[model samples]
Target: MSARPRSKTRATWLTLLGGTFGLHRFWRHGLRDAWGWLHLLATLTGLAGLQRLDAFGIDDAQAAWMLPLGGLSFAAAMLATILTGLTPDERWDAQHNAGRSGGTPPSGWGAVLAVIAALLIGTTVLMSSIAFGLQRWFEAQAEADLQTPQRISVPR
Candidate 1:
């Protein structure tokens, strides 16, 4: 038996809000999909890594461990959102809205919102990564400068 028809609007919302946790995938494919489980696990692990960073202190070298986890979660979420948003209505209906009556097509607002969300989220993530890199670089530079001996100049 086929799964019941799923609404693209609801799916898009889920993908936007919880794509990293695979809630959207679970909505699409149910609980048995390993990919969904993987997404969920990776997201949770990433969250844990973030907590670890906070617990360990931001300046601690170990805090860097969270960077990749955070990046992966953000990237996965963005990808899922984009794919769900860009999918044509007929295709979405074929893959997910099968066996149902006149299925609702995605609204223009949904597409527009998805585009906006993707841009905002993508930009935030990119900016965050660049900031993290700059912070680390500055910290390293400070440490190196501290370690190097400074020549004392006499005012002549």
Candidate 2:
């Protein structure tokens, strides 16, 4: 049996809203796919770890592991949404709409939405990452400065 045609617009929305949980993947590949489940698990675990760290005020070292998982998940979701929306209708139809009797699926501003989302989300994520790195670097530098002794010279 041939797969039914899926809407790129709807798929883009699902990826935007629940890509970390692999909702888009489930929509495309069904619930039995291990990749979808893996995405879900990783995102959930990362979020849980972050919550725990925040609640307990854990050390930065402890929080380090969680950030990668969360950041990776966020990047993947945004990128997937962008890619899905930007994909040409013909290619999308060939990959996902083939064999379906349904006429042309309406794309409905998919490219526009994708471009907007990519610019907004991508910029925010990139900025936040840079800020986080800067904060960590400053903190480390402050620690080092505090540890170093200041030199004093006696004047006649």
Candidate 3:
């Protein structure tokens, strides 16, 4: 089978580099497949929760950096996919070619997954500690309140 000619209009290059900034969707296609568009919607919901949990210092009405991070990850994944399709040399020729690892990009998913797991475990432990402290504080306050009970109207 004949090979498709290399695109010279910079779509490939833009898609590869724009991945870092998450501009690939707009470069490859039109405005319809915008990367940050749908990403922002989902991030908004997460941002609400983020605020509730005080994850980030962002205001309740404002957007969070999570939206941009999501888009960037999308771009990274798609560009890596495209790179895996081409030969090592061909991929190197493409713009922003992250050195081909045996003709394939490293599976960054594992790293992301591991980091997520670590963060979850860490947060759980921290919350547990904080809850324990709060529980003790509440018990002490209740004891004090009982010891200093206000005199009520006994029998008229």
Top TM-score prediction, candidate number: 2
lDDT of 1 by residue, 1-156 (tens): 554567776777788888778887787778998878887776676677678777887775655645655556666777778777778878888887668766575645776587579768966875785687578778888999999999999999
Rank candidates, lDDT, best first: 2, 1, 3
How well does candidate 1 match the true structure in TM-score terms? 0.72
| C-alpha RMSD of each candidate structure in angstroms | 4.6, 3.9, 12.6
Residue 101's lDDT within candidate 2 is 69
Candidate closer to the true structure by TM-score (higher is better), 2 or 3: 2
How well does model 3 score by local distance difference test?
A: 0.43
Q: What is the C-alpha lDDT profile of model 2 across 39-75, one tens digit per residue?
A: 8987886787678678766456545456556666776
* Backbone clashes counted, model 2: 0
Higher lDDT: candidate 2 or 3? 2
Model 3: lowest-lDDT 10 consecutive positions: 1-10
**Candidate lDDT (C-alpha), each:** 0.73, 0.76, 0.43
lDDT of 3 by residue, 1-156 (tens): 333433322333444434334354554445677654554444454445445437544332232334333333443434443543332434433543334233323434443443344344435534543564455467667878989969888796
